[model samples]
Target: MDDVHAVRKPRDSWWTVFLVDPVACRLTLLVADRTAITPNGLTGVSMALGVTAAISFALGQLAAGAALFYLSFMVDCTDGKIARLKGTGTPFGLWVDYMGDRIRVICCAAGLASGQYAVTGDVAYILLGAGVTVLDLFRYVNAPQMKRVREVVRENRAQREPAGEHLARQDPAGENRVPCDPGPAEVAAVLNEAAALIREASAQPHPGAHRVLRLYRRIGRFLGRHRVRPHLMSGIEFHAAVFVAAPLLGSWALLPVSTGAGALLLLNEIFLIYVLWLSTRTAPASPIPQRLPV
Candidate 1:
């Protein structure tokens, strides 16, 4: 029981921990278990809500847009919770979720720009929207590459561990090397579990692939702890900020604000590129596995 408690992933976001998880995710989990609603169904609803939110913003209904956008985000959070709890996630589900998120970003950003342009006649807002779109595209594109790098690291680490060591003892480079939060002890336990899974996957590729794929779903949870996460524009932080600003800033202020945010996100993309480069460059020269065709 203590080991089980020790291996549970820690919440990385205050918003998710204090608000979204306790309220939105739990409510969705209840509804999901009691109803016929599938996770993909939730994803579809989220997509519609996001598109509607964008349209509402374009029509200058800031309050409605903000509410709708929040609803979309809530459902987006719920679907993954449902997927994990129900063991229903698949490679196809991941692709759908990925596409849905991108669609929301594009539609919402474009709508905000259109509305702002209508109100102020500034072409710069259009450029801002384009920039957000580009950054979002890059973010999604980078995720698979990051996963590939992790797989390489996992494989390399597996090869380096002593042949007769226990799985729990075979910590790859030690969790201390990663500078984890939530104190060292809890992070150490989680990394042990992660290392065990990685090593097992490396040893037995057939059943291990499924196990690793299941573990891969938690990649976002792990990567959320990366030093560069807070700076990324195409993430929950920026998404929440956009919703909050929509109602408070209105069209006139929102465009310029979002433009600045998008610029920051673009800069973060460069940082992510550098991080990926470092990982791949330092990784052992093993052929990367073909990523899920998402």
Candidate 2:
């Protein structure tokens, strides 16, 4: 049981942490203890369930489709937990997991759009489906690029700083660091530094931006104390909002809920982009590498 808990991600979407992890953890323990099923095998199960969910949606069984989709996601979460708990994780497993998620989203989107359009004879459902698919793709594609940009900036900063300066900045007290369990003070320090960087980058930043940053900092500190990330509308949450919440609201609420979820997702992504840009502005100048090394 302790080992199963240890497999949980240190930071993950609120949806996953609060809703999925509890269910996934028990299933993971059962699988690891009782079965010989591999992580890849679990991925296959998740994919199968996802396909069935799509079929349900195509048949206009919205509630059933939503429930199946949620179950599929639960199994998807379990696979990773089992892999981590048993130390059987592999790069191939990672690839399968990633591809499986993409395929599920695509199929679900098509199933949902077709189902809704058939019911209402509205062309807009088709467009909404495309919008959802595109938004998911954009989130996944842009996330890695944003991460790479941050890494490059960090590397550049490290290179420009005097030897030991970067390390000193990170751990000024020379205390041993626990990477997985950062304290609230540490989190606040990082947020404060980021706020300072943004202020320094802008000659006269908007009052609203300052307020937002301040609120973010406070929220970061609060969530940090509880070991929760401050990103409330990440990809996982977005998917849940669209596939689970929207459908459960019934056909009448589907379109509006999905549209609102998409908007929130975009807004969150834009906010992250703005922060990354600010960080880059404060980073030391260096030519970005033509390609990231393998």
Candidate 3:
């Protein structure tokens, strides 16, 4: 039980936290206790399941495909947990996991589009599949670049600010902190302040911005209590909604559900960009200090 708790990520997407982790964590424990499975081995299993799911989709077995995809995802989640628990994580394993995810998405999209078009004789399913693949690609590619930009911004800010001031800014309460683990309260406070700053920096603040921020804060606080992020429509949730929920709701719901999920994912990405821009805009412009002539 303690191992399960320890293996869980401190923060994760809401979909993983609510729907996947409970099962994944237990399965992770079982694999650790009962098997000689390496993380790479688990990755292989996940890839196999994902491919099977794609094949099922190609046959128009929507329900079966959904179930298998969900199971694949569950096993996918477990591989990481087991790796963390056993300290057997490897760079090769990470590469395999990342590539496996991309392959699964592409395969599933092609299979789904082909099957649906075969049934309905509509070209839109083909377009939808292509669009989904592009969207997923965009999200994955943009995420790392965004992260790199944020890191650069933070480094530049730290260099510009005096060391004492930077330290003070990081720990206003003057408590010693772990390097990467800012607790939920701190995260919520930072986000709330960012939203307020963004609102104030706007030429004409939206009237509903405050209310929206407040609701966001409330939701963030609620999810933070469970170690889940407030962004409910992240890529993980988007995938689950498109593949699993849409299938369960019947073939007719697939288009609308995918569209809605894609829109929400875009909105979340836009909001993040807005926040980053506002942070840069509102940041203090301090000059680098020069050495006086000796």
Candidate 4:
């Protein structure tokens, strides 16, 4: 038996790619439990491939780097699928998953740092982005401390507002989303609805059926109205995607692709100040609980 505790069914059906979303992974695993590969083993394998890819990219071997990159993603996808299948993917495994993510992020730095300082012998533009990346990394690392500070401020400063206050606070453009802390009863209702949709989607041949599309549209409008987008404007997804694309594009042979990809990455990062500013905003309060400052 795996030493880790199985994660309670989490609510993450939309994140099949990372396969890190426990609840959706759980459902997927139980429903397809024949091939029995251990999740941790797969995690190790994926990490190895990720490190290999980073090394390849660092060495300026773009073709091999690209292939290994995809291979690492496959390992990532497969591990979660295996975990869900084996019922062994615990929160500990989830922690390991994030560690794997960190490894790749470092790999990204290694690749780019090599490109700038070693390969091209130019440290101007690359150094600038690297500093930004480090600051972004700090934002993530200090997220817990930042979250506590904010909650303290919120509890002390935010008076319980009447429902009317929600009107201006909810901006659909994903600007300044008002806090919507629905209590337990309301949270239960939302969970029930989400579970129902999942069941319905599973039964249908097209998961993105008419009903699902309608739900997606409604959600989009709701997010637009309240400006309640995922707290991931410059999220890990955008970070890693851009990191890999940069070297591949900018290779002496692929200059145009390099310039275009770099521009897109810069644009996305510049526009998404929300992510960097709020990585520590309102993360799920840790179960063990942190000491609040007096």
State the lDDT at 76 in candidate 4.
65
Model 4, 109-175: lDDT tens digits are: 5675575456677665366446535644654555444444544433432344455542333333632
**CA lDDT of each prediction against the hidden true structure:** 0.60, 0.77, 0.73, 0.47
lDDT of 2 at 142: 75
lDDT-best of 2 and 4: 2
| TM-score of candidate 3 against the unseen true structure | 0.83
Per-model TM-score versus the true fold: 0.66, 0.85, 0.83, 0.52
CA error at residue 284 for candidate 1, angstroms: 5.5
Error of 3 at 270 (Å): 0.9
User: Which residue runs does candidate 4 get wrong by more than 4 Å?
Assistant: 1-34, 125-129, 132-136, 142-233, 252-294
C-alpha displacement of 138 in model 3, angstroms? 1.2
Question: Per-residue CA lDDT of candidate 1, range 1-294, in tens?
Answer: 232223223433434444455556556647655897877989999999999999987887777887888788778777876776666778898789878988998898888778777987888878867876776676666655555555655566456666654345455555422222331112223333443444455544345433433453355446546422122344555665665464566655665666676666666556445444443443345454534454
lDDT for model 1 comes to 0.60
Predicted candidate 2 versus true structure: per-residue lDDT over 31-114, tens digit per residue = 898999999999999999999988888889989999999999999999988888878999999999999998989899999999
Ranking by TM-score: 2, 3, 1, 4
Best by TM-score: 2
